[model samples]
Target: MIAAAWLFGVGGAILVGIGGFFRLARPALLPEDLRYLRRTPDEIDAAVPSLRGWLRLVFIVLGGYAVATGTLTIYLAATDIRNAESSAVAVLAVTGASSIGVMALVNFALHSTFRWPLSAAAALWIVATLMAVVS
Candidate 1:
C-alpha cells in the first residue's frame, strides 16, 4: 500500500517535472486553440520569450528540486508500509484532494498551462494511493 502511494506520488512528480522542463524547453508546445482560454504562440513568446537562458536554468533547477523531494517522500512512504495506516497518510490524502481543486481553479482562471489539469488528476491518484496504503 505504501509502495502504491510512493508510485503515484513519484510518478506524478516525475511527469510534472518533465512537463515543467518541457515548458522551459519549448514553450511553443502549449496549446493555443482552447476557446475558453485562447492562448497564442505570440502571447507565449511575449510573456516568456521561449528561451530565457538563466531563467530557464532557474526553472529547471526548481523543477528538479520538486522532483527530488517528491521522490524522497514516496520512498519514505514505501519504507513505512508497516505503519502506513496513520495520520500522515490522511493528511497526504487531504492535501492531494485539495491540490486537485486548486488545479481546477488554475485551469479555469488561468486558462493556460495544460499541465495544471494533469497535475490535478495526478493529485487525486496520489490521494487514492494514500487511501489504499492506509487501508
Candidate 2:
C-alpha cells in the first residue's frame, strides 16, 4: 500500500511539474510543439501575430487542466484511494483516461517530444493503479 501510494503520488507529481512548467514558461508553446507546426516563433509572428496570444491561452488552459488532474490524483491517493473500493478505481481510471491518456495519445500522434515522457507518465499511472488493485 505504501508503494502504491508513493507510485501514485510520483506519477501525479510528474503531471504537476510538467504542467507547471508549461504554464509558467515564457515560450508559452512547447518548443517541440512549435517545431511540429513548422514555424519558428519569429516566423509565426510574421505570419499571424495574433496567433501567439491564442496559442498562449490554449497552453495556459491545458496546463491548468493538467495541474488540476495531478492534484486530484494526489488527493485521492492520499485521502481516499488507500481504503477505497471499486468505485475509487473507476474514478481514477476514468480521470486518467480522459486527461493523461488523451494527452499521451495526442502527443504520440503528433510525434511530439512530449510523447515518450508522457507515455512513461501514463505507464506510472497504470502501474500505480495495478498496485492499488493488488495491494
Worst ten-residue run, lDDT, model 1? 26-35
Give me the displacement of residue 102 in model 2, in angstroms.
Answer: 1.5
Clashes of each: 0, 0
lDDT of 1 by residue, 16-57 (tens): 565466445643243532344465556646876744465466
RMSD of each: 5.0, 2.0
Candidate 2: RMSD to truth: 2.0
lDDT for model 1 = 0.54
Highest lDDT, which number? 2
lDDT of each: 0.54, 0.79
Supply the global lDDT for candidate 2: 0.79
Task: Compute each candidate's TM-score over C-alphas.
Answer: 0.52, 0.84
> What would the per-residue lDDT of candidate 2 be over residues 99-123, giving only the tens digit for each residue?
7888899998788877898898888
